[model samples]
Every structure is written in C-alpha cells, then in structure tokens.
Target: MAIDVGIIQDVETLLKNLNGYELLSYAICNEECGAETYEWLAGRVEGILVDEFRYLAKEKRKHAAELRKLFEELYPGMKPLEFNAPPLDTLPVCRELMKTKELENALAIAMLSETIGRDIYRKLQRMSGDEEVAELFKRLAEMKEAAYEKLLKLYEAMEK
Candidate 1:
C-alpha cells in the first residue's frame, strides 16, 4: 500500500514528539492543579487532563483533541498550555532548580512550553501542504518565540 506522504509525515512527527508531548501536557496539568484552585471539579478535571496525556501518546488525534479541550478550559479564550517545555512527567527534571518560587516554576514551564511549541509549529509549517495552516503555524511560532524571550528576561531578573 502506497502511503500518503502527508499522512506519513504527520504520523512521523507525532511519533517523534510523542514523549515530549506527554511530558508537556503533564506539565500543564500539574501547573493547573499545582495551584489549589477550587474552580469546579478540580480533582476530576485534573484527573482527566492527566489521563489525556497518556491518551495523546497512545492515540494522537483523539488525545490531542481532548487535551485541547482541557487547555481551552484552563486558558479560557486564550489557548494556554505551552507545548515546548519537557512533558509533564519529565518537566521537573527538564526545568532547573525551582526550590523557591512556585510561580517561577510555573512561569518557566509556560515559557518553555510555548517556546518549544513555536519551534515545532515552525517545522510543521514548512512540512504542511496547506498554505493557510503553514501560515498559521509560522505566526504561532513567532508568537511563541517572543513569549519565550519575555520569560527569559523575567527569569534573568529573578535570578539577580
């Protein structure tokens, strides 16, 4: 069976980034729950988010959609949950020593997550056959990189 090049590459991208995706999703979930927000059914919702992380790895499309829903709730109108930083399960290790401020850790995670997402988007943008989607990803990557730079400045200030 001749494979559709686009489909194959998309799958390849997913496979390549599966581990990172899970970790990144997990990180966002952890950060969301990290704060003791008594917003709705926090436990159940958080549980779902965590579950979605594994699901994304095992079933990309479905899991990605589910995770998007979780992020939609988390960020409301704006799509929060950066995709660049290490996956949630491994983010703690990927991030530096954040012994002091929880906020700092959160900031770092979000910053890195967005930064990484930008890079991925850029790559996908090039690979995408759809001109509009490619444009979207290109724009997204720029925005993410900008956000990451802002976070870097913030971190630098905090360090001093």
Candidate 2:
C-alpha cells in the first residue's frame, strides 16, 4: 500500500496552506478531475475494472455536485476560485499508477486516492469555523472512507 512519498509530501504541503473556502474550491476541482480520470480509465479498461471505474466516475461527479451546492449555499454569489487542479496530478502517484496497464493497479490507485481525499476532508473539517461547513467536511470524509473500504475489498478480490 505504499505510494510515492514525494507526491504525498507535495500534496500535503499544498493542502496545508489552503483556508476553508480554498480547500472546498480545490476539492470541487479535485472531484471533477477524479471523475474525468475515472471515465477515461473506464474506456481504456475492461471487465470488473470497467464497472468499478464507471461507478467511481459517477461517485466523483456526485461528490463534485454536492461540493458545488455547498459552495453556493455557503458563499452565496461568490464564485469558486479558478485554478489548475492539484490533486491527482500534483500528487502524481495516481498518474504513475495510471501508466500501469494492469487493472489491479487501477484499484490500488483508486484506494490510495480515496485515502488521501479522506485525510484532506478531515483536515478541512478541523479548519472550518462554521458548524455547517465542518459537518459537511465530516460527512465527506466518511464518504471517502466508505469508498476506500469498497476499493480495498475490490483490490483484495482482484489480487486473489
């Protein structure tokens, strides 16, 4: 379950500086990118992996939509900050895993990404000043944890 230490450090450093709003904005972008990446992978892969990727793609979109809705409710007329996404690529362990043709590697990457996301959401929850925002992040972190559990089971089955 080892991912690249450098990538993890870079992601952690980048996330450390973001405030609650910025973290939410980046999370929206991250979810969108994750959906896109999973969709791309679905087309490239086959069998059970295809279904899993497609499911993950859908889940990512749902997460992005939820985040967007929260942003609207919390920030009102303020727009989300525009910037290049820094999740999957900047934390390039997933990108490197993407290069591997093995379907099992896909599950590994997905599991690892969910783990990273859970940590990010937990940090955001801790940083939130508003009760609602903190609750939202807590729920999101739980969702990520659930996703990781599902992926872990899938990975173990794939390994067998």
Candidate 3:
C-alpha cells in the first residue's frame, strides 16, 4: 500500500506572485482614496489617526518595547504622514488611484501598521495561556474593536 504524494512548494514562485502589500494597501487606501476627493477631510482624518497609533506603538516602552525598532526596520519613515500634512485646499480632486509608487507605498505602510496593531492583541491572547495576560488580551481586543468601529465610521463618511 502506497500513496502518491506529489506535492511541491515553490517558495520563489510564491514570493514573486505575492502582492501582499498591494492587496492590503489597496484595502487601506481605497478605503480613503475611494472618497470623492482625497483632499476630502475624511481621508486626512483617518490618516492622522493612523499616525497617532504609530506614535503610541513607539512609546509603549514596557511590554511592547521593540515595536518601534521593528517598525523602523520594516519601514523607515514618519509615514510622511504629517500631523499637518499639505492641505488639499486647492488641489484637484485626487479621484484616481495612486499613479506613482510613492503614494501606494505609503498606503501599504499604513496598512502594515494597522496589521501589527491587530496582531499584537491577538497574539497576546494566544500566548497568554494564563489568567492575567489572557484577560489583558481580551481587554486589548475590545480596545481594537472600538478603534475599528471609529475607523469604519470614517470610511463610511468617505463612502458618502
């Protein structure tokens, strides 16, 4: 008795075909860029909130100490997401998908940060396997849930 196990995993092929960032960034950017105008305050608001999260992650010096370092290594910028970024006062409606790579790259980065935030709580819950930390994860998850809700509201506004 034998089984025909003809299975192969092509790592390089998989990597080449993977638009991991593109897919995720597209989701994040389109959520905002889908707006009637990127100059629209909605996109700008969400962008700023996302930036604030990056700051918090950087400042969490106790438990999540290495987060900022890893963030820098993975992406080395202030996300070009200024607290007071260039205004959209007179710019034409940026109604098209990002034409150049820079905007798309920035969006990809934004998605990555959101993703890491999601992972942190989820991972803590899994790794806790105990009373205290598990409870902490539960609390953290709820926090994330609220943040997601707020983000959805912004996205919904963008949709309008």
TM-score for each model: 0.40, 0.86, 0.33
Candidate models: Cα lDDT each: 0.44, 0.79, 0.34
lDDT of 2 by residue, 1-160 (tens): 4567777677668767887788788878988887888798788777898888899889889988998999999899998886585454326565555576877877777777788788878877887777887898899889889989998998888778
Give the C-alpha miss distance for residue 125 in model 2, angstroms.
Answer: 1.4
lDDT of 1 by residue, 118-139 (tens): 6555665666554644564476
Give me the candidate number with maximum lDDT. Answer: 2
Winning model by TM-score: 2
User: 1 or 2, which is superior by TM-score?
Assistant: 2
Give candidate 2's TM-score.
0.86
lDDT-best of 1 and 2: 2
Q: What tens-digit string does per-residue lDDT give for candidate 3 at 71-100?
A: 344446733121221112111212222332
lDDT of model 1, residue 7: 39
